[model samples]
Target: MPSPRPSLTLTLLQARETAMRFFRPQLNLHDLTEQQWRVIRILRQQGELENHQLARLACILKPSMSGVLARLQRDGLVGRRRMLEDQRRVLVSLTEQGEQCFASMSLEMEKNYQRIQQQMGEEKLATLLELLRELRGVKP
Candidate 1:
């Protein structure tokens, strides 16, 4: 007889779903989708970036990033400028408005993260992080 699958997969799935549920409400309050927030967060982390670099760092496809960039530009949250030396390269950065939004969302994100850490406890969270890195074929 075939052996039953391990329960770890289910546990991981449940953890992901629960975390998303917890974050979704906070994101909604910021009037941002998860993808939009991700782009903003990436820009904050990397400072200014070229369009292609932003797409890669955000882990989003070029086409999707085009739309995200458009929306952010329309909302006055981000600004784009052509590189002085390389006119073909379009650089993207968060505007003051975008920075403010990110700051607000960052606080909420931190709170959510702290809650999760508290709930999972430090040791379990550390173990989970190590396991995830290993699963991703990354050196932990």
Candidate 2:
């Protein structure tokens, strides 16, 4: 009989945790959780996005996104506004402080990324990223 295969989902999660090991210190130093860092990163790149859109991109659930946004808002790192055209729709964006925070952390994050690329050569890192993107595009 053939040996059992390892669980793909668990393996992917473990890989993610391994990758996060390099960046978690920076996040913790800024008093940010992984979820908050994701939200901030997305907002920085995309400018302003609707709450649902932000949640989806950040891989956060609707229910949990509320708390995450609440904390960010409370900390004055992000701001939310209701759409005038669609009252139900909420928009989220990074505030000045959020931008500053991102700027402050950019150097450390870049260094960590460089360290990773150095450890796992640029070609290998590129291939891994491409494979992950392709895997994400796979249809169930």
- Model number with the top lDDT: 2
Clash pairs, candidate 1, are none
Candidate 2 structure, TM-score to reference = 0.97
User: In angstroms, how far off is 61's CA in candidate 1?
Assistant: 0.9
Predicted candidate 1 versus true structure: per-residue lDDT over 65-132, tens digit per residue: 99999999999989999999999999999999999999888878888988999999989989989989
Q: Per-residue lDDT for 96 in model 2?
A: 99
Evaluate all candidate structures by whole-model CA lDDT and list the values in order. Answer: 0.90, 0.97
State which candidate has the highest TM-score.
Answer: 2
lDDT of model number 1: 0.90
TM-score of each: 0.84, 0.97
Worst 10 residues of 2 by lDDT: 13-22
The lowest-lDDT stretch of 10 consecutive residues in candidate 1 is: 131-140
User: How high is the lDDT of residue 136 in model 2?
Assistant: 88
Off by over 4 Å in 1: 1-14, 137-140
